[model samples]
Target: MPVTEIESESQFTELTKNDATKLIVLYFHTPWAQPCQTMNQIFKTVADSKASDNSISFLSINADELSEISELFEVSAVPYIILIRNSVILKELSGADPKEFINSLNQFSSSSSTSTSHNGPTPLATATATKPQTTSQPEEESEDAVQERLKKLTTAAPIMLFMKGSPSSPQCGFSRQLVAILREHQVRFGFFDILKDDSVRQGLKKFSDWPTFPQLYVNGEFQGGLDIVKESIEEDDQFFEKALQAAA
Candidate 1:
């Protein structure tokens, strides 16, 4: 099918949630971004090549026009691509590499037809599964730099959540529940989408010595994951208050 331009969130939802679609290639771009100009053509070419496949669909979203959808995925940059199959994130790619874009679509389109599970795709190759590009790795961040960055991030707000997706659209059940709990308690928190930044995603595991996500940090200290946070609230109704007060 030809690439459909997503005009609104409702339209996007209707098209993406259709049962017939086995693979959805979402291109998030902004007209002002220089990189997006190049990626626009590349995306169209790739989409055109796959036009014969009825089970696969391509969508182009203006990050600014459909702000809610962009924010749902925590899209911080333009010229981004997200592959989805059955509501699960298959892949996320950033930047304007034509070869990488085409190659990824080809890989996932073939796999989407055979994959029966509703779960996200398995790691493409260990640590690089969430890596932004298929090739052309970014310079490694020094350990000290990573540590310093994590330190600032943890304290970026009084309450911080490092989760799989944004608060509005949690990618996993655990993350959704944690976001609900915070909202129930009327807590204001900042969140970092681990899916967007592999550096923070991997570094945070060691930084807090927590191997899992939906991690809650209170006043720059490790609070816990979903279960632990629930337990903390159960133990003390004043848990969030105490944490914020301590920072104050």
Candidate 2:
């Protein structure tokens, strides 16, 4: 399906509520944000690629214009994306990372296709019989496992930034400033939103012994928050380059 532009709250409701079987990919953005501009192209590309998939729908809404919709989703940042199926939110991602965005869409497409195949051409009785077994699976994660996951995530990329939101759209002022600094220095980095995962958020405070967010990490080692980053940049012009090199 082609990408659709959401003009009003009613339009958004019409698009999402009318089709319970479609997967709605809602993109909340603003024209003023440079990161949003970058993400806009990526979003369109993903939509175009998935145009043949009748089960998926793409929508772009200006956060500034559609304040009601933004507020409903608590979208305080631009370039935020929410994946919905049957009016239920499956996942929410905040950022302008093309690779991650595409990967997510691909995963969803595969999973949704698989689900449809299983559900399609099935007798009502068989479908009902299998539904209960699927719903019985556990959904809990252990504390030790979460810690281990956090450890791996910090070093998932060479330059990792654990912030309140994404590098493109930051939820907090500190995170916004840190993103600006990183961009100003022309640094290529990967980010994880602490706000999205409570386990990572709370576990990190103890893991790195850093209570505050917008924390920078290079090659798995903890760097300080926004204030320390500013001071480091002031003291050394090549702060980012040197830090990355040391990590390497």
Candidate 3:
């Protein structure tokens, strides 16, 4: 079958619950994200190849449009894919890495075929799943390297927010409120979901000496959390504007 665009939550439930479907490939994306443009074609290409196979189904879901489904999978980023089998999450792929998506689909789809005749589908093995082919151990990144990465991430945009979830789907109350504030101010900013990366989540705490999340940064400088942001706005109506001007 061709790739299906899910329009409603009820439709999503009905399609996923189909008894004939042994494998469900879910593509969660938003129109604004540029990476989704590339992954969308990749998803269609692969889905078309297996169009004759009734056991596998591909679904295209807009994260913003289908917020409930995106929330169901805890999807915080666009161009994300989730593989489901027998009501169980088999594997999840993030980002727009075409090779990774294709290889993973092939690996799990073949496994699903074999496992169907036996027991039910099992979750992807976390340990050996993405293990490197080399026999030698891999070297860990140096402290300086990690710091450098954090620096880059902080300045990824003029206004950066390191929060628990995406701006559209905030995982925590503080993050949700912060997003509301930014929107209220009509401020355009970029955000990083710290929940997805433990390294950044933990490293950022030390880097900025801030223990809590929902951290905001202006020009790569630590700007406090939600409370501080509110206070800054209270003190100066043009807080965001001033910060951006300073960066310029």
Top TM-score hit = 3
Which 10-residue window in model 1 sums to the lowest lDDT?
125-134
- Cα-based TM-score, every candidate: 0.49, 0.50, 0.50
Candidate number that wins on TM-score, 2 or 3: 3
What's the lDDT for all of these models? 0.77, 0.73, 0.77
Between candidates 1 and 3, the TM-score winner: 3
Q: Which ten residues in a row have the lowest lDDT in candidate 2?
A: 125-134
lDDT of 1 by residue, 128-181 (tens): 112111122257988888798888888777788888866645689999899889
Q: Put the candidates in TM-score order, highest first.
A: 3, 2, 1
Q: Per-residue lDDT for 242 in model 3?
A: 95
lDDT of 2 by residue, 139-248 (tens): 47677877887778888777777887554456899998997887677665667767766777888998999899989888888889999999998999898788878978
Better of 2 and 3 by lDDT: 3
lDDT of 3 by residue, 1-248 (tens): 48999988779879988764488889999899999998888899999999987778899999976654664565678899887777777677889998988887888777754333223223221111211111121256567876987898888777888888666588899999998898788776667777766767888999989999899998888889999999999999999999888877
> Native-vs-model 3 lDDT?
0.77
Give the Cα error of residue 126 in candidate 1, in Å: 26
**Would you list the clashing residue pairs of candidate 1?**
none
